[model samples]
Target: MRYHVLCGIVVSGLLFGSAHPAFAAGPVRLPSAATVSSGAAAAASVPQQLVKITDVTNIRQTPSLDAPVVKKAQPGQTYAIVETVAGPGGDWHKVVLGEDKTAYVASWVVETAENKPGKSSTGQEKPSTGGKQPEPSRTILNIIDVTNVRAEPDLESAVVAKAQPGQTYTATGTEGAWYKVSMANGKTAYIASWVVTATTLSGSAGQSAGQSAGGQVFIYHTHNRESWKNVAGSKSGSSVDDAKTNITLVGQELGRVLQQKGVPAITANDDIAGRLVLKNLSFTQSYSESRKTILEAKNTNPALSYLFDIHRDADVPRSQTTVTINGKAYARIMFVVGTGNPGYEDNAVFAETLKELLEKKYPGLSRGILVKSAHQGNGEYNQSLSPTSLLLEFGGVNNTLEENKRTAAAFADVFADYYASVQSKSK
Candidate 1:
């Protein structure tokens, strides 16, 4: 009767066939948060000895490997510090992370300041380089054939404007290859420098527009532990904390799927991890605080096309919560759109296109599209990055962890096909 409370699950013969595999059924009791430890949290609390090396895919370990086999550490994974080094080829220190766990990350990967954890570093930050430069100014230059103006420094954030060649503008500043230029209408805009050559430079740097690089794909995982924080099951006594652990697992599984599928995307790294930039946040933070966080981060990477904010949902009955795939229980993939941002229409079209494409290929795995009109916090969910931006909910908290993992694999394949189709047609 606990299953009777499900409001979101749809019963269909396709979910469970006669086979009824044993793996389809989950543990007698759902997992508790105390059972799973976060590497990011562990890493931040490490002693002043070790360093974090990579931007993403940082692996924590048990003992330590000269070159260890990475078991976990997807986006927000971290390590604890034990010792420190002086220079570039510094000595690697080691330490324990979680219960019965230990690992050694490179000396460079970690920030020295974190050793003194919880202390405010804001006042000690360096002064601005731009302030020392001459007055903020630009000369009107012809626009390239195609370019984009992003809300942040990265390609994954929302896009605010697009620039076409022949559109003249004054160059204000440059962040890497992206140039912030004054628009004809006096509003500031950004364009990828590679796409346009300065009219003043003229024939010196002439390059065909056809040779321009295609738009990039930016991927984000909004791992919210607090979204599930207080949510308790109607039938099952599973608390929001339990639900959050499963959601974290979903984020990991989804990342594994993308890597397995070789999808070109950028996920956050622990060293760069901040509530708004790289580290995971609560659902409340993502809908509100992270909005500004992503906006600023996207400014650094400007060549984005598709932006995906991964999530997990709850608040459904046990029966409706279970998702079965290939006669095996798996989580369902849900594509969500918030009807609040300026790009809602475009986002809807993009979601529809993706759904149509996937349904024709994979079918039922995609549990249709869910549009949260009034309840979604900011209503944008950062979908304004592109018409193709969307929030993807893997499955409800009630679903088994394995189900979510398998669903990630399924979605990866579907995504590869979608990218291929787009490439073929663009040709």
Candidate 2:
């Protein structure tokens, strides 16, 4: 259901291109609590904060573009912020439309006065309000790890949020090693101060995948339906649902590279997404369907140790899909590993090694390894079956299949070195 929400979202007065919103232009939405240091900065204001509209924008009833438009917001018009939400569609700012009515505008459409030290008042001012206690001195801290934002300072308390790696938060106060962080919606959450770094945020690089390659490798994709069109010198059509046309070609490309490098690699062209159709199951069942194929392969040949699941990313905008390395176009890759299973460390090391190898040779090719848990999309991905299993996202829907194939070639080159190193070690 959520992936469906991310397929495509168009909002008015966009900071990025009008065609499709850029990935960096919007908030990263995961199944469960992922991470965000700017949770407090994420929402609009709690008490009505004044703002001036910078563009002609639609006033929607809800945060998503899918919501009905209440009216058109005029430029230079002043309105008070009622609330703000970082929805899958993008950031929406709730504002007063009239004396008794309200609607939401995209965050990009307005200039918030809340950026300043104090609040702004309406021209029709009321009587003086009672004095209030001074807010505590706030300290901005950088999250050094994937730490949980708790309901209370104590660990036993419920997890209200997750401080994603490299995200910064404004802490109001502290109780021992825990610091109190304020959120945009006016709620307070706590994160372990020790888990956060005091100085700065982490950069765009990734960690080293430290491990030798093991056994023959298996290559597959759960989102096998991911495809591209019109870029490989084709005049018409986009992604094909079948393996021969879509991401499967990318997998085959990588496999060819691996085989050329003398490493045995197999590409399982099972239409994992199509299996869900046969079962009449939701799209989430894709992992389950692919897992069966992986197990069968492993059972038939134990040499299949390492696994790669390749698919295109739809969550990010298309402009971000292409990254030029040495003036050549290539699809960027994000390695996602689930922590709910037993082989997390091994998988992480494997993923990290692949990233390190790729970045070392290609540079900016890997988007760092993103860790997910049972709390997030949660299928074991059957990765637990092998220590070196990985789920790789290459580019997005906007990327042409040809661009993805180029990336696959680059990835295969780096992987060959990694596989050869492992083989040498095992021997």
Candidate 3:
């Protein structure tokens, strides 16, 4: 149902040539003849607009006819609710479009619905009225080794509070490591920036995947399809359901990497086995609600210092789908951090650690951490359960299934190297 909502959304408002021969093929229906008048405006304060042509159009770089193109829109480009003055020469009214990407558009081709007019009101008197909005939710960070919440922006500042590797905290806003946050009380206070790791925000550039033990990794698309109902990518057919697969592969890889370094490590599936490697520990929904499937593997596994949830992105481009053995485009990886929970700082630290290690080994294959919106992707996805937890998106849907599968195997190898390194450090 939710995916359907995403599918229906038009990213931008642009129309080229007509898709169908005609615009109106059906008869128009009128509202009941006797309608009572309502005082409320027909449309809300938020903006709205529509596309003009029958087919999709591209959002261009400039407002003119010759502007460079950015992205294309599907039929019925949906614009915000607002008035658009006509663009130069063209019948198109210039407008901005899309939720994830706010590209601009022309209006001549699209038509605006008859907006119910709004009454005149004081425009300058609103922001001050809403006092102290509620504080946002917090997240816990697990798997970090050492961390401290400080008073000032710099590391030299006094330690206002201290947090362990797997400790939890309520994250608010940030300036470097200094966070302006609410105390356990109702009032807000400033905490040291270094005290907590900062998560990547939404729409930020992704980290590039590099070669460590694994140059590229992909999660099997069929894994999710075979397990869940219809959640796999219907369009791309490459999206995994959750992060458990990444964790399982990592665990197994760690065993082999440890053996290579003479550490005598053993690994098994944590969800299917139910071995009680760790008791009662679990991540929250922002991590994933369905991780209960992992219950089967956890029963049969060994205790681990970290837990990872691996996955991949969808609606990606085909150019990013190529994989080469040496000096070639294989697969890209994405790291995600959720800001809607208590351990945001801790989780950020863990993400940074993983990125640092993976970058050193893989070079450019690992993409940076993606700051997730609370509105989508498990909402913090499963990071809140432990400090060491992370949700990794391997590649977009367009990537070939085999490339993605080979990428996953490569990830397994990198995890092995990371495990050996961590063991040596603990010693």
Instruction: Return the lDDT, model 2, position 324.
Output: 89
Q: Candidate 1 local accuracy as lDDT?
A: 0.47
State TM-scores per candidate. 0.47, 0.47, 0.36
Of candidates 3 and 2, the better by lDDT: 2
RMSD of 2: 23.0
Residues 158-274 of candidate 1: C-alpha lDDT, one tens digit per residue: 667554322344456765545576533456555543333332211222322111223334445555542342343323344344333435555545545554444434443211123
Off by over 4 Å in 3: 1-223, 226-289, 294-302, 321-329
Best by lDDT: 2
Better of 1 and 2 by lDDT: 2
TM-score of model number 2: 0.47
Off by over 4 Å in 1: 1-214, 221-223, 226-239, 242-246, 269-285, 375-377
C-alpha lDDT of candidate 3 relative to the true structure: 0.41
Local distance difference test, each candidate: 0.47, 0.62, 0.41
